[model samples]
Target chain A: MAKKLLTTLTLMASMTAGAAFAGGHIEGAIKARQGQMQLYAHYLGILGGMARGNADYDAAAAQAAADNLLAVASLNAGSLWPQGSDMDSAEGTRAKAAIWENFPDVGAKSMALTSAAANMATAAGTDLDALRAAMGDLGGTCGACHKAYRGR
Target chain B: MAKKLLTTLTLMASMTAGAAFAGGHIEGAIKARQGQMQLYAHYLGILGGMARGNADYDAAAAQAAADNLLAVASLNAGSLWPQGSDMDSAEGTRAKAAIWENFPDVGAKSMALTSAAANMATAAGTDLDALRAAMGDLGGTCGACHKAYRGR
Candidate 1:
């Protein structure tokens, strides 16, 4: 009976350890994805500035910025930010519970920003003035997410 | 004598009008540039939010934000904000006499932000972690400008 009890205990321990590993993997992926997202926004500012200033007015730079945004657009955050995932994480990320709580809105907004950015790039080479106008809409998407999801 | 007097009067009147026009143009440009610069900062907050959120892990969004910053950088305020030009303006633009008084530093800082942003865009695609680190430096540029040139 003692041997059987010991065997049961060992199995329980292994299951617990496996669960922890799985949890860590998810968390790590979320952190890495979040980091990438933040960097993406930083570059967007550069694109907006260039378009508004007519700086360099080069197609290459415009295309490069657009390509980067398209990559971001493809990210599927629905599975990434699951419920209870916002609890004290390493990224010092204030991404609140509202992210999961209101997941649909968050996803929709992200998609909207992506669409706006894509449209902006399309206008970058041929019609800079239109691109400039679209930038405001892109900014609005950022603001909406911060208002609804990010914590102080 | 009458003809000479008329020529002298005409020249004096033209000189006075020229001075007034020059002053008006400088003042108007300063105000306009100041407004644009302030908007750039406001947009920075939006971009920062997206960056911090890693909104879409998007390289294009990041580049777009970085590129858009050139508007604030290329704004050559030297001519627009001549020394002592803020005597009567009331846009709350606390642009000190030192803006024109110390134009080179102002130009340098603006250029610095531009360069930093360009470097950031390049880094963003190849080395996102480095791009994340550089964001603080970019923000410093904005704060430095506000502290030195912008008014409350």
Candidate 2:
């Protein structure tokens, strides 16, 4: 009877440990993904302000916007995802297995978008017209990735 | 002598008119760029908040950011430039002539970034991770434009 009790306890402990590990992984992914999304929103806002003429054009504002955009451009998408992180049942999640299965393409498209954004910021103050044009391409790159990898 | 005086007055009038036109153009561009810059800053702040867990990861914030970005992406850089506007003379201007020369490419990039941002927002609630990943690409597109066009 003692031997059987000990076996049961060991099994329970292992199950708990496994669950904790999985929970930690999902939480971490959530945290990283949140960071990425925030940055994306931030840059877009800056670009919108510039287009609308609502903000006063000044060196300080221009420099700040450019810098922020560059920072956003630096984020790498692949680093944000972990294997088996789909948590298939999580609310606000439509991630499919394909993210990990065809990760390379997703990564490539992400890089492409970053490169385009960087170029736009660089030209923003110096060449408003060119910046406008570049902004479009940058948007396109983002679309390409979403069309393939994003579930919704 | 009367002919000469009339000529002088006419010249003065024309000069004043020219200055006024130029000033208006400069002011318009400045206003537009300022608005865009502020939008970018706003988004960055949001992103930062999301990353630090200061803001809830929800559809509302995500959608707002995405919508703002799309609005920014739609701005036409070429239309912002007025004839005779120059970097050396214009106040609140860092835009160089290169913008016009490279207008097509710049527009394309901006659109790419916008589309990606929109996609991310659309997917925010359904798949935060996927949305995050797409945001990464969107950021990259912003950078690409900055690298080539923006100048200190």
DockQ of each: 0.02, 0.02
Writing each residue's lDDT as its tens digit, candidate 1 over A51-77 gives 667344444444545555554444334
| TM-score of the B chain in each candidate versus the native B chain | 0.66, 0.69
Q: In candidate 1, residue A101 scores what lDDT?
A: 50
TM-score of each: 0.41, 0.41
In terms of lDDT, the poorest run of 10 residues in model 1 chain A is A12-21
Off by over 4 Å in 2: A1-22, A52-59, A76-79, A87-90, B1-152
Tens digit of per-residue lDDT, candidate 1, span B1-152: 23323433443243234432244344444454454454355334334545576343445434444544543344333323433455344344476655544545665666667666666656554545655776788788878877887655
Native-referenced DockQ of model 1: 0.02
What is residue A44's positional error in candidate 2, in angstroms? 1.4
lDDT measured at residue A42 in model 2 versus the true structure, 0 to 100: 45
